[model samples]
Target: MTRVFSERSSTRATRRPELEAAVKLAGEIRSSDVAVTLVVHEHKWLGRGTELAMLTEELKTSDVGLEFLTGELKGSHGPSGIVFTVLAAMSGMEREYLRDQEVSLRDIATGAKKGQHSSPATVMRMLREHDEQAATAASA
Candidate 1:
């Protein structure tokens, strides 16, 4: 009963219209009770306007919802130096929460490396601990 969403920007054209369109689409999807996320890539050789137009058209009637993930490889760079960027959007609040927790866990793990000792294993352990805490907090 939850929704998650995300976006990815292409480097081909970082124009305002395209960015706006993407943001608008994201907002619309998120407002509809879908959790939203975004990722942006840089592609300077492509026309932002054209790309935006194409994306706008493509996403006009999407119903399953979107979860945008950036940096996913779609294809190789073409002769024109054009690169294919991938955008993945998922729908669901539970998914969103889990995603957020994973992100936080990663951050904690990374930060812990600076001085404290923490590994992915430790992070997972902490996540479980926090989950229990959360459940306790909710019950109270």
Candidate 2:
């Protein structure tokens, strides 16, 4: 991946090997003086809540920063921000859409358990169910 940086800031892709190394080093240092912000292409990679949570915790403890959208910092950071934002947003949205696929897969598994045909087209119902369950669990 490209190492994009300016006088006061720097960024790396979510899946970059350099970032992995940096995180490892940061873990060893455990110094509050070291600050790093990891900016995610919010539209591309933030869909995995568990992954995000774990990474966030690791980075937070090591003084690393996580940014969800680089496009928002365009014009202010680098020449690529404006163009990257559109691509990043699209990527993030695409991942978000896969959660729908997860709902379908869950339905399919449920149907198999019940000896019934599964229909994955029920987007509205699945979203509502997921939202309500998430809210209930959150409150609990």
Candidate 3:
């Protein structure tokens, strides 16, 4: 929960009603310094990365601790710094996948030139293995 919801409040950046309620609640009860856990079924509920980063920082400023589980990212996380790190890495991750795709195309093209498939299977296998490893790490 990240903000107090009001029907008249037009500035709620996060679309999740529960988050807004939680934020409101946390602010009210923050004298005891309790942490809030926010569960999100969709990453979009957090809005853009910048929005999320700012929300976390706001929580910290108000002495409200925040922990979150997001289905899109599929993990439980706390700490505002981690949000910035994760957002920064997202573009690099996308770039890695895009480069892999290009490599696959080049690999097959090179094989075709020689009348063979130059084993693009290796690239695909590596990608699958990477996926498996990531799943394992996430589950752990």
Candidate 4:
């Protein structure tokens, strides 16, 4: 029944629909003398931990009650808020690792390292880039 609304005036792109539905449902309940308890998933903001909590405080006790918590921190997500922080971090790290792998390929193409794996793809890319650099230098 406690009207627990967040400081945030708007919802994130992914959460907007659910939050809007809650508000709409609350409006209907408010028109009546009935009280309802609505359970919603808890969500947190990235780098701002729970900065944009949902409209729990906004619910009127006389009309409805709203609170949500999962068995684990179902709501604790990363910057996207949909992906858990650890997963998000790991995904980025994976991409970086892939890119780092390409560095060795580049080394092989430039004769700085031995091509222990696929030789053609990396060398092709290197040749293209080398030609581009040469053309730019010629124009300069």
The lDDT of each candidate is 0.37, 0.40, 0.46, 0.40
Model 1 regions lying over 4 Å from their true place: 1-15, 42-140
Using TM-score, rank the candidates from best to worst.
3, 2, 4, 1
Error of 3 at 123 (Å): 23
All candidates' TM-scores? 0.22, 0.32, 0.39, 0.30
Rank by lDDT, descending?
3, 2, 4, 1
TM-score for candidate 1, please give it: 0.22
Error of 1 at 62 (Å): 19
Tens digits of lDDT, candidate 1, 1-140: 33223234333323445555655766677568665443433222122223433443344333222232232322333212212222211112222443465644343322322223222223335667989999999999
lDDT of 2 by residue, 23-77 (tens): 5665555464544444444322332222333444465556544455543322222
- Tens-place lDDT per residue, model 3, 16-59, is 56566666676666656666544444343443333444555556
Per-residue lDDT tens digits for candidate 4, residues 76-109, read 2222233333333333343344356774434432
Best by TM-score: 3
